[model samples]
Target: MVAITNTTSLTFLKDELDATLSQAESALEVFSEDTSRSGELKVCAEAFHQVRGICQILELPAAALMAEEMELVAEAIGRSVTPERMVGTLGNAIVLLGRYLEYVQLKNAAMPELLVGGINELRRSAGKPLIAESHFFRVDVTRERQPPAAPASTPRTDVTRLCRRMRHMYQVGLLGVLRGESRTSLKLVSRALARIDRLCGDAPMGRLWWVARAAVEALLADEMRLTPARKQLLSQFDRQIKRLVYEGERALESDAPLLLVKESVYLVSLATQDQGLIGEVKRAFSVRPRFTDGALQEELSLMSGAGGSVIRTVATALKEELNDIKSTLDMAAQGAADTDYGDLADTLVRLAGTLVMIGQSREAAQIRGRADQVRQWRNGEVDPEGMDFHALVDDLLMVENAVATLERRFAPADDINREVRNTRISLYQLDEARMTVVGECRAGISLTKRSLTSFIDSQGDRMHLSNVPSVLVGVSGGLMFLELDRARAILEGCRQYIEQSMLTGSGAPVREQMETLADAITSIDYYLESMEEHKPIGDAVLEVAEESLAELGYPVMRAPQPA
Candidate 1:
């Protein structure tokens, strides 16, 4: 037994209890006139009843006895609470109890001065009018005690130990709900059902066991409403739950308890209704799965159904761009500038938009920039000497074809194996095309550079010849130099075109092709350096071009040593 150290502590407790009681009593008076204020009266009455418990715990018999009567009055008023009488009785009870609670708290404080202002405020409220029936107030000198009675039902065999075993499963189900895990929640519900089955036994507290089983089954069915597969799983769980409940009753050898059966049936019906409501809500609001793991496939399927037309339109555009690029390239090769590549450009732009729609922004930006450049160059003014008209057309058409092939290869589809195989084939074909184009460009630049060097050399040699007239030599040499400069400028423009093509197609690994092009250009520069008398000017230009191309993954090749 615990010993009470300080009897003075009880005085403080009594004072606090009185203050709470007083507050309850004051509110009761205000509520008495209006029966519509019964809700307020009920709340005040509950406070008074709570104060009564605290008073009894502190061993203040007088305060505890008064509190017990107040509780009885409060309970009576709460049952048939009318505005006027409930307010007068219940409200008054709450005020008196509130004051009593406060006085007890004040006396318990280490310093009485700490509650000086508080005590005064409580006293002011306690002065308010309350309905006091004199006959109900009886103070008895004698106290009687009675022995505790045994409970009608015995406690079950350590079922709380079973709850401990299933604690993780319960948390998993709860957490799954918070995380929106439809399948995972169902799985947890299934585990909970098994745990409940293991714990069920012959006990007076069997109703709790039946209720828990029914609740878990209901939860399983509810969680499954998110997906068709889970719904089928729920049907299986439902049959099992019903069978389990039936067996438990049969083992009892009595008419199945109405409470267990009624609750089980009610929950099943509620689950069915809730499942229908979930389906309706999903359909009405167009709810889709957001997480990527198992939910991605479901969400993609839903998106395919809802936005099939938009996806088809993008596929059609890609196919058209492929055909247009092929046609344009053939026309360009024949030196025809009349063919409009605008359709290819337009398709590429739309493809970029489609990419963005499907969540591929990085790839989309590359396609968009290439298409925009092609469109702008086609429309804008061109430098007569600097432009390679045919090469420009070829580069644009190649970019269009490459982008279209990429789209066809990676567009989300049901048959991913076939698509992946086709993508690999397309990638191989694109690499071949890139190499062929780079070779043709290098050849064209080399031939033009050689011709320029030959012209310059021939004219310079003639001007130095003693047999030729000075005026004629000057005129021929000047005309030849001008032609040589024009040819060099044209080759330089071809180099720029190759560089830009490499930059645009940088997403593809074409470093080998780029290196080959750079090597060919370096060969042309070496030939020019050996043949031309203006070595300094040619060498400076060659160095800059070499550095730029090298940075673009075109390093200079080393000469082979003797074996």
Candidate 2:
């Protein structure tokens, strides 16, 4: 696995790396302007070479590989290749790398797998064979793996014929997958792999089949996307089947391909489903949940879009321009001779072009049409109260509303934060009830903590903690009202601990037990606070509370699984 540690040396090099990337982009732009300046290509290559060295020094394998591919693209351009065809790839690489660095700095950890798509794009542009998506995915292929049980019925006498039939089954499913019939087709593929696993039981090749089975389960669960690279990986599995059909039963004893096993294990790790074989694989590999493919793509979309700061700036400028246009339209409506409809027409045309550039195609078209009408009006005698003039003013007002909406949509982050901070309790009955319950829960948790603290201080006095059970019961009731089942469950466990352990046990609670109970209470308090603030309540908090409750020997029941 690629480590995400950010060292002092990496931090120190970040600014210089950004400057070098900028220099490379500028040189590429210059070279695009005049191809004869082959020297600019050399400059670009040298910059990328520096970037590769820096990434290598930092032990950023993926980033170093990206820089190497970028250098290759630059050199390819120097060798009389068309710069236009490759500049976009190079430009995207530069921008994406910068954004990724910012992402790492902000998140305090790197997920280099997220950069695979961009890296592959650079490699493709450099005419290099694409790397597997699981290139960074690590797993021990040589580890012992148990295969699925063999069929209880009579064994197949002709192994080659049986294997060939299974291969055919796999091919049919592969066709469905290739044709985009994923959900059903994935089952067929998985079923075929299941048969193969049973056939290869206790053989070295069975591990590959086992992993592939889980990988397909992941795909079927929609944990991963059917990307081009993954499609190729699936195709490679067909060759594995052919090996078994052609080479006889001994082929089952052949060692599984290391890269293939790693990729399959990687897919299993991405799976959200934790049931049966997939769950078994995760436990064996000690895999933890990371970003699913869908979540990763969403993050990439946000990073690639115009930054909030830039959007807010553009929105501000657009509103100012809209105000100017509105003022001119107002003057025209009032029969002001200095209205200068022709000049207004020019301004509207420019505004429309800006709208188009900002991805507001419909708005651009409307503005452009209005501008054309104003151009015609400039040549005619004007009537201040004319329907034509009135309609133009109304349209301008509509456009003003759109500009206002855009401004709000892209409001500055600080302004949004301030607004949230200033938000007052709603007078609506449902919201008021929810907040009231949350407040009650918070106070109850506080009381429970104080009672527990006093009980610990008193060295086993039931009098100090007598009311904790009732207080916890009230909190659990309030949590149920708020529809927070998880928190209520934790509180239920806490109530049990107070009633059964601290109140009735022969001795005072141990220090570890007291701390664990305290931790559970604090987690619920935090949950209630988050609820009142209208912030998202993450599952991690519930997990912490649940784990603490379990440590206290009064574990809450697991939440109900979704149907």
Candidate 3:
């Protein structure tokens, strides 16, 4: 494809494209004003269709996609009278496309990626799935990986049967992941991947499994969100597993899908962790994240909106001016002596200039028109008590509402559904103490797991279980202090089980019992991690811990709800 810059023909084409976009904008405005104007909608469709063709000729795929989506939305509007939001989206797309053409002309380059957001918005308004940000991102996935430790297996192991079982395990986890059970499903997926990695050994095919495991770990670590694109990538991993089961070990001989590898590597790069396989993969593949999703969205918001401080200052000044205007209008309507029409017109004229300075040219024009009306009323061209006076007041009220809308547009977003609970305690000190206790509890859980591992290895050694109860008790006390009564109860049950059965039993607990014990401990670990992150602790995890204990013949006590 030819470069977007330094092209005489492209410059001519862009000028023509600009004319078409303006036509689209005009048609869209007509349809928006009167949704019954299907012919205007058809005109918009034709304009965007032409715009799409021009983009394709210029080799601007992203831009073409945007135009194509806009055209489709225009057609949809013609089929039925769409909502105002959809019409507004179409209008914005028309304006944005025009601006993008100007940007390309000025910069002498076409950076199509910047148009992805607008394209997605058009698609969204048409009830279509959004394109991922990485739709334009390309990367080399042929780099050889430093394979993780090979999957443990014997010479007699049936690779096909093992692959089938592992694939089943992966599917179960994928279902959970799809249902939004992120933490638990991620753990299951990681486990399956670890097994698959062992089967693949150090061959080229093993690369996808290990890299995918790292990516899933990153997801588990809250390194990135489980976007639809990422979820689809994980689903592709299952397809690879299916290949191994049907195609036999030969599937492992070939490289994994290039897109899958790139996406997994991309995910690993986004993780903040600099240790273990995730960090190692980053080093080996030389993958460094450009930005996480949240960070990228934040940067986009900053680019699109005026600076916070600038907007706040403008808002304050606008409010003051509007207050004076309102006061004058109110007093004049009541026939007060302080009514001064000339002063009011002058203030409105200045306010119009300020609105234009803030990039509100349409609002500025409206205010300027109102100022002209004020002047006419002052010259006795219209009665102050007539319909004309009432229209002027109504228009001023609309401008006041616009000012309020501007304030809302720049206001910090809040999740009103998750109301922060009020407390009488000093929240700062309480939060600090909670953090300290949560940290210690996390440390204690880690220590207990290690001790439990040693006890299992030592085959009924009492010493390995000695420090377990004490550490758990300490963690339980911290949980109580933090008002996590359920977590405290679960920890207490584990403590009692270790004390009453494991340490005092004649021999090592059976393998099944030890596994169940591990399950209980692991569930508690997951809960604490969620708590530390301030995420909502689901009841399912606690039930899992309770079931594990019950299986071990130690029925857990239901604790009273925390105050």
Number of the top-ranking candidate, with TM-score as the measure: 3
Q: For residues 1-563, what per-residue lDDT tens digits would candidate 1 score against the true structure?
A: 11234446666565565566566665565556555566655656576677768756765444454555555565565565242443344443344434433444443422111122222223223343322111112222121111111221212233343333334334434344443444434444445544444454443333333443544455555542333323333344444344334454343223334433333333333343334423332223233322221233333233223335555466566557566666765665565656455765676687678667766677567677767765755533433234554444444444444455555544422111122233224443543443343344344445544543443456422222222223223322332342333224323433443434422444432433333343334433432322221111223223333443454444444335559
Provide backbone clash counts, one per model: 51, 0, 1
lDDT value, residue 164 of candidate 1:
37
RMSD of each: 34.7, 18.3, 14.5
TM-score pick, better of 1 and 2: 2
Q: Write the per-residue lDDT of candidate 3 for residues 1-563, one digit (tens) a residue.
A: 11475467668887789888888888888877887777998898898889888888877787788888988888887665446878888888877777777766665756555677788888888888877655666567787776455544423136676577567657756766776656666775786787678767776788888789888988877546676678888888999999988887678678878778878887776677768888878887887555555554443454354345787788788878777887877777667765667788888899889888877888789879988878755543445689878776666665555555566466422111122234223333444577788789889999999998898888778898898998998998878777677778888889998998887876678765776677678767766665555443355556667777877788788855659
Clashing residue pairs in candidate 3 are 151-198
Model 2 per-residue lDDT tens digits across residues 130-149: 88888776666665564344
TM-score against truth, every candidate: 0.24, 0.52, 0.57
Please list the residue runs of candidate 3 whose C-alpha ends up more than 4 Å from where it truly belongs after superposition: 1-19, 81-85, 95-117, 129-133, 138-149, 152-212, 219-266, 269-275, 279-295, 306-436, 450-465, 496-519, 550-563
lDDT (CA) per prediction? 0.42, 0.73, 0.73
Ranking by TM-score: 3, 2, 1
Quote model 2's TM-score. Answer: 0.52
